[model samples]
Target: MLIQLAIIGLLFAVFPLALVLISKEQNKFRKLIAVTLFLTFDLIIFGAFTRLTDSGLGCPDWPGCYGEANPFQAHSEIKAAETLLPTGPVTVAKAWIEMIHRYLAMSVGVLIILQMGIAWWKRKSMRHSPWLPTILFVLVGIQGAFGKWTVTMKLQPIIVTIHLMLALTILGMLVWAWQREATQLVLKLPPLLPRLLPFAFVILVLQIALGGWVSTNYAALACHDYPLCNGEVVPQLDFEHAYTLWRELGRTGSGDFLPFSALITIHWVHRSFAWVVFALLASVAWLSRQQAETKQLGNAIFAVLLMQFMTGVATIYFSWPLAIAVLHNAGAALLVLILSVLNYRVRSSAVPVS
Candidate 1:
């Protein structure tokens, strides 16, 4: 089964590999990086879909569906489980969703491995240090570990939230690595802009983590009102219960019923922090627009920020439609990518003059 899974992953990975190999780009290595980065973004989005659809437990096992490579091989078992609990997490459709997600994740891992291999093989010719890809390989390995735990641990909110954050972090790191390898870095901003970027990045990441926590905890509709949670500015909350670091999906740390207040706390914190993150990022965006090189990027950031705010509100107003919620996650990922680029451009040395 393991060997079959590996073969399947390799087959999925080969398309991108073939593209890199055949591309006419002067720097095929960079093209490979771009391709890998694009796929990682897609992986993150699909992961959000898997979580939102409650397919995280569709297989109820790690690395395979009921110990088989594809859902078809495990069809009987999946069907049996579905029959036992028709509305539970193991329906055939969900099993496929979960298994397909795994396949994509495995494919991304394979691509990262190839990335590390190529970086080392061409170290002398590569502009950037090979260590970046090496670190990314290690991070991807860690991500796989988290992926396993996300299932084995039964979608425990902390584990799941960390898994989501780590994926975004890896995506950001890849963006940085890509930026480092660029042939020419045209974007330039004032010194203060770069200095402010890291702080904004940190804020954005924390906000994303909180957003993940809200989703993992199923707290999206806890309050059910936009700008005012539970029809009150400061609804009753149970932060101690909600913020407990080690607990199951819906229980408090002490295994008591996680109170409605706790859900309110989770929803409220995420909503409140969104404003802070938006303000910080918007400030960064305004500064970015002042400089010629960063204006476009700043504009991109502003656009995504607005979309994020809109989707966030839409999720609440529309009572958490799956598409809007998924788009909200995509918006978060997009924000991370844009901020990562801004951060990279600010920190890296000027693009070499042509």
Candidate 2:
């Protein structure tokens, strides 16, 4: 089963690898990184979809479905489970979803390995240290471990949330590495930007973490109204139970069923902290727009921010529709990518070119 799974992962990576090999660009390394980054972005979105669809336990195992390489091979077991519990997490569709996610994750790992190999092979000619890809390689392994824990640990809220965060971390690192290789242009920006960009990045990461916590805990619909949670300025909250990070998915630290107030607390904190994230990132975007070199990225940041806010509200108003919720997750990732690039540009601007 493991060997078969390896083959499947290699097969999945063939298309992107071919694209990199056949690209017109002179910097195939950069092209490869870009492709890897693109797939990582897709992986994050699909991970969100898998979670949203309750497909995390679709396989009930790590790295394979029912100890088989693909869902097709495990169909009988999946069907049996579904028969036993019609609406449970195991089903044909969900097993496929979970397996596909795992396959894509493996393909990404392959790409990162290729990246590290090439980086080392051409270390002398490359401008940056090969350690960048090496670091990414290590991080991807850690992310994979978290992915396994997510399943083995029964989608423990903290584990799942950390898995989500690690995916974004890998995405951010890829963005930073790609930017370094893609361009060397420097921007002339206000002094405040260098200081503000990192602060904004921190704020955005915190918000993303909160967002992940909400999603993993299935708190999206806890407050079914927009701008006002359950029709109150501040609904009754249970911070004590809401943030017991080591507990099971829907239970308090003490093993009690988590109260509605706890879910409300989780939902409320995510939504409320969002404003600070928006204000800070919006400021960064507005400042970025002032510079010609970064104007497009600035505009993109603004657009995604607005889209994120709308999708976030829509998820509530529409009662947590899957598409909108997934979009919210994707938007958060897009923000991470854009901010990474912006930070790279800003920091490069400060450095005196030798």
Q: Number of the top candidate by TM-score?
A: 2
The TM-score values for the models, in the order shown, are 0.97, 0.98
Q: Candidate 1's residue-wise lDDT over 146-231, tens digit each?
A: 99999999999999998999899889988988877775565545557767888899999999999999999999999888899978
lDDT of each prediction vs. the true structure?
0.90, 0.92
Question: Model 1 segments beyond 4 Å from truth?
Answer: 186-188, 350-354
| Deviation from native of the Cα of residue 10 in model 2, angstroms | 0.4
